[model samples]
Target: MVNAPAEQKKLPSWWSGGSVVYQIYPASFKDDDGDGYGDLRGIINKLGHIKSLGVDAIWICPHYKSPRVDEGYDISDTDIHEPFGTREDCQELIDAVHAHGMKIMFDLVVNHCSDQHAWFKESRSSKTNPKRDWFYWKPPRMIDGVRHPPNNWRSCFGGSVWEWDEHTQEYYLHYFCSEQPDLNWENPETRQAIYNDAIRYWLDRGVDGFRIDTVNMYSKYLDFPDAKVVAPETPWQPAGDFFSNGPRLQEFLREMRKEAFSKYDCFTIGELPNTPSLEKILSYISTDAEALDCTILFDLADLDHRGGQYPLMGRNWALSQFKALTAFAQQLAEPEHKAHALTYLENHDQARSVTRYASDAPEHRLTSSKLLATYLLTLSGSVIIYEGQEIGMINAPKDWDIDTEYLDVNTINTWREIKHDAKVQNDPSLLERGRAGIQLTARDHARTPMQWDGSKNAGFSSNPDAKPWYRVMESYAEGLNVGAQEDDPNSTLNFYRQLVSLRKAHKDLFILGRFQLLDPGNDQTMLFTKTALDGSQVAFVALNFSAEKQPFELPIELTARQSQLLISTLGKSSESRELDAYEARVYLA
Candidate 1:
């Protein structure tokens, strides 16, 4: 087998071609100035750590001006940074990320804005307001002389989508929280204002691109038809389908691409809902010139176990399911559309992948982490590494709870309604189950303060007396912090560092190569290899998902005399070796 290049190669031009993307949850990364929340400066401080991980870029969760209704997803102004810092701080953070040889992608939440935003407040003030059409507003239906909501649409936050405005005797639609009103993209002025400010804000700040949030929800059906209702037992709402992939979504995205995104050599990844069609994905992320760089697909998110009755699965980590899903995604991403699909296992809204997919066995956490990394990075597409995945962090313990005062609106309302409905139905178990599901689904679990150390509060907040925006996972106390991991070569941290170094060392083979999935039908394992155009093949990725070692063979015919085990979680490897339980290996081929 060929030896991996010894020297560090120049940053791959194909990094923009499609490479690793790290998702950073702003509130948990680090606290600057003892604010008890991560700020731009905190990210700035960790640039070296991020660079060390071998990610080509980062996607920062919103730091935009917001009332924190949905943890900054509720935008007040796309142009302004929130109390997190000034525009200058954002610029500095962008510069720092670039300085570390990593690009930065800002999160763009365009579907809705906080009620406190001046535009929303003005639109709600009067029916005669000039900007009344800027948002979805309709006269309240006078049913039996009592004002009623305009339509049957339900808010994803579990209430009427329309909120009554006493001053104007009108109701406005909000897809998420009532305080975060949906914008009327049907109105050109509204679209233009959002586009103009948002595009300039980051481009001027030197951000490499944007991860467009809730992109499919930006355009709504003008008719606002009632969606097919989900059964009461399931929390799923039909109303989402009515607006999730609206007719004008592509039109809006096209305009977004043409006006703001297309002008520069920027990368754009759409956080699209549903599994968008291949044609759609290609149109959105194709290298052909007028589209986003890639789009994060929900293939993995939709692979949850179904209780048989629901449209989607409940929660079961099946290797077969993961294999099938990833194979389908890879087929779409293959050598031709390599830059189109953004490969990711989990994000802020989903349960942590290591905990969910890897089974979280202490003995197997590292193995599972390596398996997942091998499966994701070797695929032919852009890759997004969710925060904390590199260190093998598992989901937080279920015992943790978000007290009412500390909960964000979306989650707090969900907790309240689930409990309220359970009490009405005299079903205590429903409430308990709901709590369990919340624990599994809460973004706060992942957004919790990063495990910096074993110190009180995990060394996230400067003042020991201060409280962080979210609880820190107990793994910190158990010695899973950066300070501890950095010193241990056998730690998960070093494994990731080595993984990055290998990719950097073999830039041609790893970064700009053609990827081929070795065996797509194997459920108990994953195998793939990347080959550069010049005939140099640097690595082979293999993962064992079965609890017991399962025999498997490579699909490709290898001429190399031997394969060197470059990195592995099993701690030992050879040219021809069996993978231990949940073991993952990257071999020089």
Candidate 2:
């Protein structure tokens, strides 16, 4: 397998490609300094807790200096955010992560920079400035009698990607919010600068590796073509195809690897979205590739959504489609591909899987969460566990005021847009739909403060009176926090811990064995078997994706083999049903 570099090969099992990763949204994790926000010191304090989960590495979302317009993805500088901590605090976190026998991955945002960044400031200061070509700046086109953006490209957040610069009398492009401008990768100086400052700087600081943000979006065509009109009512259109995986993508990646990553013993997981071709996705992680070791895809994450995270567009996803996309990713483990992938049901950008993928009703919450965990941990690839997911956290109540409580930029934008549309159309259904779907695709659902205990502020903030950046889920007081699950043997938290151990105990079969997806036509249960390459053993896995009981028989390939139960979400099922609601079982033969 293209798992590790020569030096990394000598390290522990977790250092390999199959290592489990725990992702922490630092702003909502814990407020150790009592500043009403989570900081590096808080992560340092929780190293033991994360280590307890048997994770090989921790990927803390961007704590970089920013205006917080897009939650630190818009970087003003490469330095650590003051609210989060200092450069010394970052170093301390790296030391602490290593001391706890785990690696740390930084979020690298090379696609864009905050408008206030010195580079952007210099670039936009004057048309003749030396750094003027470092970012995308275009002259507005005349539309009838009014000036309009150069193209119909829409910002990922909302509205036009080209923002008017009254001072410069030109428009600069931002793939996200207007404050975050896309960098020009065509310029060698820009590429070299990022390589020197962002890439090598962290590697020089003893950090393990990185989770490169939007890795495929680094390059773009300079011609600046107009996008197809998908939604005529909207001022801008979805122009992802025009900017993603551009011609120079591979060349730039190879250059970055040669100039930085190849020089260090590190690991990298790229955040690659809007990429649908499995062949293109595999190329990056292929055994012969010269770039990243692994990549995270959004193919399965947006299955239930209609227009890529739009409000009130949630739709029921077919189990067959989910299985096919899932199996497509598993192809990385094939001998021909010889690559690796990371599996997860939740991340920093989506609502909790307990509510989105499975029933969050009191009756099914625990088993359903465990069911997802079983599916995640039993795969042949590395696993990623988001914060609070281990305890079966669900979405916040929809009645919360969007203006005051839902403070996320995307959430605020969506709320305002839908609210205006509702009023203009003289139909209250739009606003109602937005509220009804708040738990469906709102980014704020994923940004809620972590629930550590049942105490004040859910033990996230030491001060009982401090109002944290986001509202803490009130359910924490009802035995949904880690403190309550820490000692409960049957809790979802403990169940995840057990599954982690189970995966490690059979790493050979779980990580390197062949992934045989069985019963592809079944609409309720996900049934599969991992067969050791040597044909000496096989582990059969069955996962119920519904709240109702399901009956299933093992495929003939595994039916006659005597097997021992390795793990099950519903422990020692007493029900007459063969597979209890949301039950998952793994048996090794």
Candidate 3:
């Protein structure tokens, strides 16, 4: 490991702390080549729209050379995918983003590589191969004259994590799909190669930073043990305790920071899964140590999750739960803690926030959308907005037939699992519940092509007859398209723009201020304040999560201060403190 001094490490700048990032799923963003796929050229063609949204940076999903068994997550090589673009196209896109005065963050998937990768091929060639130790490979357990997997660990996709390789007569471990084999971080050569060859190569190309995928899974327990059965109904329990935040994870991350990140002026945001405790997350991103700049924890997003058998399960989240989660998240931004939290409502892996957390009714959608935006933008930590979220995009119709309609690989796999279980149990209601669960929880709801206009393919592709990789939403042409709402003064899209503008204007209060939860016991309404360190400026954000109008009273302490309305969903200032249905307001003092 490269031992760099802590003093030499580059710290995050003011812009990094305050910036809003926009996430782009390259496959579903735009199809500039009209080949039914989004490419680098397509992203370059749409930079103007991103600029108009006022985000400081854009985090592009994986575009590495891959067989696409799990979309772009299974990376086969360290080069650009031909379908997405060539290396030249990638360079041009990066330059264009810099020219537009915006930074670009690439998705970095280092926990594993595609089984088709050259390194994996060499490692699996023979037990005596020089690279044989680069991956986790072991002989299968011979029980009762039968060959079985080494352990009870199950893959995230399904089935056993250990896949038997007939060629070598050994079982190779894969936490995700069989096509994607987990890398052995314990091997110094392997970790060094990933850092020097892959990571440094990208940084040298003028890329800003990376959104590290499954970063907390880099280290694993030395002993391959059977995971405890947390959910008895399922065949295997999640092996998060053994793999998610391993004992050596922090050491490995610090080494990565010292070897690569400390030398450059870039930020690192790690995706931490299965971390229910804030203390565990803080250890990975605390600024006091040589670790990541920020981390995304799923505690808030998993509030409504049910059915431990499957990873993705959902129900209508309660207003009280939402308030509690938000309040707990805000507490992480206290002045004493060095780490920063990454706040977000939706992403490529999640369903649309409007349909999941807000009302889907036609009259209430806009107001609820605006209310969510107000709460998100006024938070103390940096925020990320998923594509299409600014325009109040909802999930696909509940009646969509998964077998016939376009669905992402994640959704299709989960649907099959749920269907098989339901059939085995001989219960038809289970199947019905599974279908409804997919409608509310499937990740494909966010993977649909961007609704740009009412033209062919939702204006995402130039060809009039080209079918997109995923089916476009039916409501795109009806009214949900960007062209339909871009110019409307009261549209959800405009409300997002206004919120972003307001956040940027009050960076000191929203970005660098101290967060305090006010009236924390209230379930239907959430009120918070961000005050400057010196108490010279203050900003208060009030959100009504209920469908019915609610009465609110400003705190007596704030009543003496002059209040200036910054932005409000109701479009009018009320002296009586009566908030309209799903209304949100920001007041500056």
State which candidate has the highest lDDT.
Answer: 2
Candidate 1 or 3, higher TM-score? Answer: 3
Q: Report the error of model 3 at residue 337, Å.
A: 0.6
Model 1, stretches more than 4 Å misplaced?
1-15, 78-82, 141-148, 232-236, 305-313, 335-339, 402-408, 507-523, 529-539, 559-564, 575-577
Tens-digit lDDT track of model 2 for 266-297: 78788778788878887676657777778888
Order of the predicted models by lDDT, top scorer first: 2, 3, 1
Against the unseen true structure, what C-alpha lDDT does each candidate score?
A: 0.71, 0.83, 0.83
Summarize candidate 1's per-residue lDDT along 414-517 as a digit string, tens digits: 67776777888898986776676666555555676788777888788767667887767788766567877888877777777776666667766665666666
lDDT of 3 by residue, 177-254 (tens): 889899999899999999986778887787778899999999887688988887665656667667698889999999
True-vs-predicted CA distance for residue 556, candidate 1, Å: 4.7
Q: TM-scores of the models, in the given order? A: 0.89, 0.95, 0.95
Estimate the Cα RMSD of every predicted model relative to the unseen true structure: 5.7, 2.8, 2.7
RMSD of candidate 2 to true structure, Å: 2.8
Displacement of residue 38 (Cα, Å) in model 3 is 0.8
